[model samples]
Target: MESPSKGYLDVGHLELGGTIQSHSSKFIPSDKAEFNRNMLSRNKIISVCLLLLVITLSGCSRINSAQGWSGILVDDDRLILASMDGHIMVLDKNTGKHMWEPDLMRVKEKDEKKRAAYGLPAVSNGILFVGVYSGKIQAVEVDTGRTVETEV
Candidate 1:
């Protein structure tokens, strides 16, 4: 303890000297030194885990054919068109191309940064339910292209 009166004495098995005395060295296990040396590097462990996660996600996103593409409408059991890019594009009943003016563009441009239309065009009964930017959801008539319901 470097006491002026004690003369740095080792009163018991404890060496009363140096910085080691200030720390709780008695709590350390005998094998911790060897165990720490063998542990894998933190950076390497994180990198390997991230690589595996990316590979798994990419595999899930891969579509064998255009059959599963979002916004694609199927009529008479045939592919119509693929609607993507934050717009409800009218696809030819065969060629998956924009048929009507992209639904979003037709609405006057508002937000400078156009958000992606993540909504899957739903055609049921005859109405289509589509999601727009900023949590805007609308049900449009498939034939007339008029909004039947608007919910933001």
Candidate 2:
């Protein structure tokens, strides 16, 4: 009768009941390089797409004619407000008709600057007072689109 220890091989306290099987340990270096290249290419494409999305969104924000952080004011039948393009647009509250649009920058012949109006317009006695980002305050008459005063 043969001893049980003679039939099994002991490897680090683990006994192998059967013969050890061997697998190919060969590695293709080109496959690894190709995988790395594919990963880098994918990362670059994602980066370019993100950059393009950001640029497109930024451009869209600027392209809009009525962009601003100011709040809207409804007085009587009109909706008075200031826009990011430094323009005052008064529209009909019910019909949404354009009553007037007074572009202060255009009146100053500085339309190229495209200043923003961050403050809400104050309406009192049928007059609208708006403060622009360029440190200018404009007083406009609600009855007409005419600017009453522009203080720089």
lDDT of 2: 0.66
lDDT tens digits by residue: candidate 2, 1-152 = 22225334323332368644433333446767799999999999999999999987887564554455577888889887777666677888999878764323232326536456666778888777777666767777877877686454
Highest lDDT among the candidates is held by which one? Answer: 2
lDDT of 1 by residue, 121-148 (tens): 5677766666555465556666656667
Q: Cα miss at 113, model 1 (Å)? A: 4.1
lDDT of each: 0.51, 0.66
Reference-based TM-score of each model: 0.40, 0.49
Backbone clash total, candidate 2:
0
